[model samples]
Target: MRCVVMFSIRMDMRVILFLTLFTGLCIADSKGNLALNGMAVQSSLGHPQGDAQHAVDGNRDSDYKKESCTITKTEFNPWWRVDLGNVYSVSNVTITNRGDCCKDRLRGAQIRIGNKLDNNGNNNELAATILTAPNGTQTFSFESVNGRYVNIFLPGNDEILTLCEVEVFAVIDTPSYICGPRNLALGATAVQSSILSGAGAQRAVDGNRNSLFSLGSCSHTNADRDPWWRVDLGEKYKVTRVSITNIGDGSAARINGAQIRIGNSLENNGNNNELAVTVVSIPLGETKTFQFQPIKGRYVNIVIPGRNEYLHMCEVEVFSD
Candidate 1:
């Protein structure tokens, strides 16, 4: 009987150890190349077959004739950029140089990352500079930098840029409050400035984060100056955070410069409440969470001031800590 009990205990320990190792391996394998989901563009096209999208099509074919590489026309400061849709803590970038010919074209190229659109993101933070062209593929590792744009700029007169593939890896930060209290905005009374077609204000708080507008799950407002959306939490409570999801189909930049306010007052349509934050940008089909010092309020408002543009929101979530 003693021997049987010891054997059972040992089996259980072995099973627990195996599960721990398996779970770690699965998490490590889940991080994939982010460049595959990005939108690629270049300064100018050189070869008829060298579309900018070719470099990120998940192919590393070195032969340019096979149409798996990108080429820019001979010009000063040629650049290629990929919009990653959402901001990420980029850890490393890998570049595959053309092996068939003219590998030297990639020399002196600079890799930059940031959210700024100035100069087509070429003026962002420099990650690395390619002094020597790689014979095949080269990986450049750096301290994690946060950005939504990744650009490759070649600085020289009469120089053409060619790349077979570009891969970006990000350091995914685990959420701390994944399981928390119930959302305060769910089933709450929501009102917007104006309705566009069948889209109403209540859809933003329906507990659905579907980003597609065609799915009838989003709220839309007509093009009006300073369009606003507000949700009443029944009574005032300390608000801890707000999460807003933007439309996925298009015009995701319409939410830029929007303001979040909280208070019980309906003055100026709750637009005069305590300011929570100013949204700079939220990538398409993505949710951005803003956490600030707890503010007490029953009405939470999101207004895009100083603008005459449509307002669309796929989801809006409010939480109290």
Candidate 2:
């Protein structure tokens, strides 16, 4: 696939490339970044943070820290900017401006995306401008604006260009979306690895989501937007092991088949596609447990593709020696 980098600034005035690592979005700050001084706007602007506007009234530059994007500035006043890593096929950007209204710093914020150009009629123009009202949180999605960099012009009506969220996508001919939560660094092992501690003893607590934002398999059947279950081995866990317990879904759920997948199913790495270690054929019953020779892998994703009646699952406790 294509590589996608974020916030990569070029100092030597050379075009850089960004790459996507697996199904994760990683912004590696190796080459650093640059500022885009477009429009007649001031460099970077200030947005009303906790008390920047209040601090201005209180005469406190010490209390306010202004974050700005130099490359992308407003057509009017103090602007905001987003220094992307490399040029991408950007559709649009979603900006959640600060919400406090008492300060006159922010309410309506304007933003745009463009690239720096050399001589000649390169044009270098991407897409149309995106403007927003002085209030509310909205997601503005647009067409593919190809460029090496993007400028998120911040509005400095108040104090600083205060923004809450930022999201950019690589849009070309592909009809796909990027999945994330990027940090899936742990490998896997032969010994048993624990994804959670005492907080998630039987039921599913928090802190077990993979790169896809899907939580690892927990005993709860009513998990958020999840129908299947999975476990990342973290390393290669080789065990002719067995035993699974702490499961029940009342009568509203039932699932079958005890199959396992080694890696991420979204972007196939071709590592463990056909390597399903079938433990047992599970039926829709009160409980199902199995014990057998297990294949060692970086992941062990158990799935119930077909919902027989409802979502059925239990806490699986694997045994090894």
Candidate 3:
């Protein structure tokens, strides 16, 4: 009986050890410093050794002389930014201050994150503000903030921005379904209300997402009230989503407020079909996807109603479940 009890105790200890190690491994894998894989830029270079890339070079050397820091030229609203390539649910950002000298220069800097490039991303959502100089390395932890760009801006006249290291940690947010393959709109027939300068409706279904209007791959309609475009898939399909690419060069807001309708009815030029989604905005030269419950339709219409404006579309793609 004593020997059996000892064996049971040993087995329980081994199980506990295994669980602890497995949990540690999962936590480590889920979080990593994303700044290393991102692209870094600053308002201006102050020193040759103080390139923006140095701050994210996986180095924490706080001494500017060591060349592991970034220094921007003394100017108004000095700033630095990093592009994470894709949007993420960022959890925390770690910043290492210049330990060698002039740590006070970092005071009053703001950390911002978002997808907008307006004012060089300075208009993004604010995450934190440095109230005092960090002694060395300080971390600002916050709730999951979704964005693709992280910016550090110092708002003042003749203020300089310096950073030794910047680290970002995040988790991947997976979507319900991945889009690719089996597109029904590629081989469909497309038509528009009116053509402008030979910009026909078929260009929107050419399977090319080239956003440049001068490239002749986009569809254009003359300025008119309630201009519309439609696509026929030859057969009824349960469309799960529609992806629209907006003009890249300029005037992307023209596509805003457009309604996406899907149904078999051609009444009102299919503009009265079941509404799928309304386009709010698509960034310049970017694609915006609208996903919803499956809607059965043979005709897909994009109509901008109650206004007189040109309808421009770089590409339109339809997907089914």
Instruction: Highest lDDT: give the candidate number.
Output: 1
Native-structure RMSD, model 3: 13.4
Which scores greater on TM-score, model 1 or model 2?
1
lDDT of 3 by residue, 1-321 (tens): 000101011343532211122101111112356667356778899989999888888888898999999999999999999866446677688999999999999999999988776677899999999999888999988777777689999999999899999988664333411111345786479999999999999999875566888867789999989999999989888888999999988698999999999999999999999999999989988988999998999999999999998999988988775
Residue-level lDDT of model 1, residues 72-154, one tens digit each, is 99998999988664466777899999999999999999999987766668889999999989999999998777876799999
Q: How close is every model to the real structure, measured as TM-score?
A: 0.49, 0.30, 0.49
lDDT of each: 0.81, 0.36, 0.81
How well is each residue in 1-321 modelled by candidate 2, as lDDT tens digits?
233555433468845555565333343333221111111222433332431112112121222233221122233444433434234556765443434332224444444555542111123353443443424335567766655434344334433444444444455235442323222212122211122222222232111111111222334334323244444544444433433332322332233344544543423322233344554444332234454555454444554443332233434433232
Residue 227 in candidate 1, Cα distance off native in Å: 17
lDDT for model 1 comes to 0.81
